[model samples]
Target: MQQYAILTYHQIDLAPPPPAQFRSLYVAPSAFARQMACLKALGYRGVSMRELLPYLRGDRVGKVVGLTFDDGYCNNLERALPVLQKCGFTATCYVMSHLLGKTNVWDIENGVTQAALMSAAQIRQWAQAGMEIGAHTQTHCKLPLMADADAMREISDCKAELGALLGEPVEHFCYPYGLYEARHAAMAQAAGYQSATTTQRGKVVVGTDFFQLRRIPVVRSTFMPQFLLKLLTGYENGKGA
Candidate 1:
């Protein structure tokens, strides 16, 4: 079976000094550049979900890794995009439809640092720059914690809203916090997304569930050797299993 690694990233800027929350979510720009350079050096092409779909469905195959950024951090555009372009890679940035141009309010209670999300124009710039924009939801709410109807609306409406904004269908999704149930997967399918990723640690193999696809995370502390292991071997998949 052909296994593919979909890597997850959150913020691609300098991490705040210690005592800030979710510090692991931040990967410094220089580190990110090195990681991408390493991928290129190894002959792997990092791609967006849109670009990876055919491979996931057994329609095509190659040395490809799906690149994804959660929460639509502005830093992704400011810092990550140029590096991705230089490496000739593309990524999917999952944004909250209703929270564009705002901070991550959903994380306020958890003490996560406030950061700017991409605005509509900035998102257009990303798409125009050959990157992809997927939907996280209308507000980045935890899907399983809400009633089915509310959850369904969050899933379906986000696609519609983002599609309208982009003039193209938003064909991918991600579970906020990786917290979701079976019904939420169905909701994602119902919302017309081709795939939905989670925080699950693993590389995707043939016959993996599209709606609940697994991912390998690249965090602040992940060094070059470990990153290569996660991509080139079954390192992370072993952990998830």
Candidate 2:
């Protein structure tokens, strides 16, 4: 069986700024670099969603890994990109369309605080640097709770805008906050995406659902030992979960 892992990261700052909403979610930039170095040292191959299609269908290969960054934070471009470039790994970034030049407003556990999102120009630069950009929806709204028509509009419109901005089709999506239901998957399909990702923790197996691909969340405390376990074993069986 072909096994694939999708790792998720939020901010890559050394320390979360005072009043930073997701202080707990911040991973130091150097820590991210170390994680990438470990992966490279272990001979893991980074595969994008497009490249993973065959593996998803049961095509076997050496250890395969997928890296995904969510929320379109500017640090993704500032911190994560350089580390990824160093390791020669490519990742998919999910951007919230309405928050393009603004900040995320729905910081539930962290209160109603905000954090900077990437600007259109920054997103374009990342695209030019070979990072895949995907839609996280127009407002980062929870899709499962949205009305069908509203959900469709959020998914489709974001893709259209991103496609226009990048001059290419935005073919993948990540659920906001890893929240979604069957209706959400249907809406993503209606939006013309080839695949969609989720916060569900597990290694993607040969027969895993493409529309609701699982991802392993990487946080500040996940050092080399934890990181290697999560990569080799699924998150459900690893320490993070």
Candidate 3:
């Protein structure tokens, strides 16, 4: 009955605050470092989904949790990586393949900052550093709303593109915005991803879905007590409106 958490984050920086619309997702750099350091202090070892896979198969079952960053922000390289390295941890970055080397136009158009994304070279450096690059679909498409065929194409093609770019098997996927349907799971399975994660809040247990896995969303509102409580207990403290 051993359990572990898969933690998800989007951006890492100390920027005062993003436009009100996107504020919840960015964790200040000082806070991010403190968060990781807290885990290290608690004897938790942050691992990539690549490394945490065996444990999900009823093996390992060690004091390890999966770490993931969505959107493949260049800040994940410029800011997050050093914190991870300092804590002796590895992580997975889910990239929107069709948008590599470009700004997050999807969010930019919505009034968020025009954040830069990791280039192919930066992603390669992440891979070389023992991190994993997972697919977040080619255009960050929401598969739940697309036709099955288009959904399949989105699921399969990003795996193909990133695998080709990295020169290695791309085995992990994460649904964009944690939005997906059962059919999307079927599509991802067909695409050959060994595991996929969702934005749902929970810790990984013996019988969690390998393809539609759950993750705890780490955000700016996740202060130390709340962060530690979520990591240790899977119960997120709700913020009031």
Best candidate, TM-score? 1
lDDT of 2 at 58: 76
TM-score of 3: 0.94
Across 50-130, the per-residue lDDT of candidate 1 in tens digits comes to: 999899999997999999999999999999999999999999999999999999999889888899999999998999999
Query: Can you list the residue pairs that collide in candidate 1?
Result: none
Candidate number achieving the greatest lDDT relative to the actual structure: 1
- Could you give candidate 2's per-residue lDDT for residues 173-198 as a string of tens digits? 98887888898888888878988998
* Model 3, span 113-206: residue lDDT tens: 7788999999999999888999999998878888898888888999999999999999999999788888888889989999999877777786
Off by over 4 Å in 3: 16-20, 237-241
How many collisions between residues are there in candidate 1?
A: 0
Worst 10 residues of 2 by lDDT: 232-241
Off by over 4 Å in 2: 17-21, 235-241
Cα lDDT listed for each candidate: 0.93, 0.82, 0.87
Steric collisions counted per model: 0, 0, 0
